[model samples]
Target: MTDLTEHEVLVRPRAAPEAPAGRTTGWWAMVLFISTEAATFAAILASDFYLRFSAKGSWPPTSEKEPDLVLPTTATVIILVSCLPMLLGSLAAARGSRAGGLLGTLGAFAGGVAFLVLQIVDWLSEWPDSTVSKDAYGSLFYAITGLHAAHVLIGVGMLAFLLVSLAVRRAAARPRGPVSLVAMYWYFMGVVAVAVYVTVYLSATLWATR
Candidate 1:
């Protein structure tokens, strides 16, 4: 056994293992998911505008008031702000800071829950007055906002699970891939929330009489 080559030993340290291909696959899957979801939303909004243009009377049928901007705007802000903490949490977890990751995850979870609550409140406030059965306007309103709300709910659930995982796992053992993936989903939700707000709420007021 003659293994005393200093140059070979020093220069040929084993290469670090490549990351699992599953992570890249998961990321591309998410991108595909977001793309499909965006197309769905675009179709819905297109239908909305088509109905708006074809209607013979004032938009929203003159009975239902245009959606309240304040609540949805607030919700949009909350969800968007939540993305910041989600991002921070992902970064913290990637950096192996357990406490910071947990805190940021918690913050993001709270914001998502708050946004969902506000969405519920807005739905309640507009109920019966602006229901799905009332008219095309109402149906579109509920369909668009409700679908977006459902997405937000799903995102909130994902964040909750991630938070729990971060809390229980050791720093080295914590799953950063999931943390980052969920953060991506959360940020997507934020973008969808803003689109929902602008399309369902702001557009109502902007083009009501057109």
Candidate 2:
């Protein structure tokens, strides 16, 4: 016969609920890397400002021959607004809706493509060297804007990878990691591009009107 007392003591308590997951350690590391990036951009911006102030003998030195920036400025507006689609894509992916996420990612990607094309068009139409002196304004303009464009290219690559991941079912099957990381990277790039657009492009373009 079973010993009732022994059996009663043998039963174990259910395990306590697991702790809620927090941001991954890798995500925190990404944040640290972004902080360093921000500092570097800030330094370049400060130097640009110093150079402009000294070269022109005034803020935005009226003498710099500003180019026709309408198309590129418009491109900047469209690109900045595309961040909404990227954010939506991230949320949709988190919810496990691959199609919805892909659509959003594609929309953002299209915007990026259009923006890049416009940048090339703008450059071809008005050689940067023609608009600003090669010594200071030209150097800073190309350096800063080129850096911004490089980041755009990187964002595009990230989006393209995400799209391929979705197409192959690898994304939904695994259903995390790559998309989330790409989204974060794209968002940071978009935000930085906006800031660069304002300081480098808008400010410089508008300076001509004054």
TM-score of each: 0.86, 0.80
Q: Where in model 1 is the C-alpha error above 4 Å?
A: 1-17, 20-23, 170-174
Candidate 1 per-residue lDDT over residues 1-210, each given as its tens digit: 888698988888798998675548878988899899989998998898899889988887789867788899899999899888888888987887777778877888999899989989999989989989899999998899889889888888887887777666733375677778888888888888877887788888887756
Q: In model 2, state the lDDT of residue 85.
A: 89
Off by over 4 Å in 2: 1-20, 56-64, 128-133, 174-176
Give one clash count per candidate, in the order shown: 0, 0
Point to the candidate with the largest lDDT.
Answer: 1
What is the lDDT for 75 in model 2? 81
lDDT of 1: 0.84
The residue pairs that clash in candidate 2, if any, are none
What are the C-alpha RMSDs, in order, of all predicted structures?
4.3, 4.5
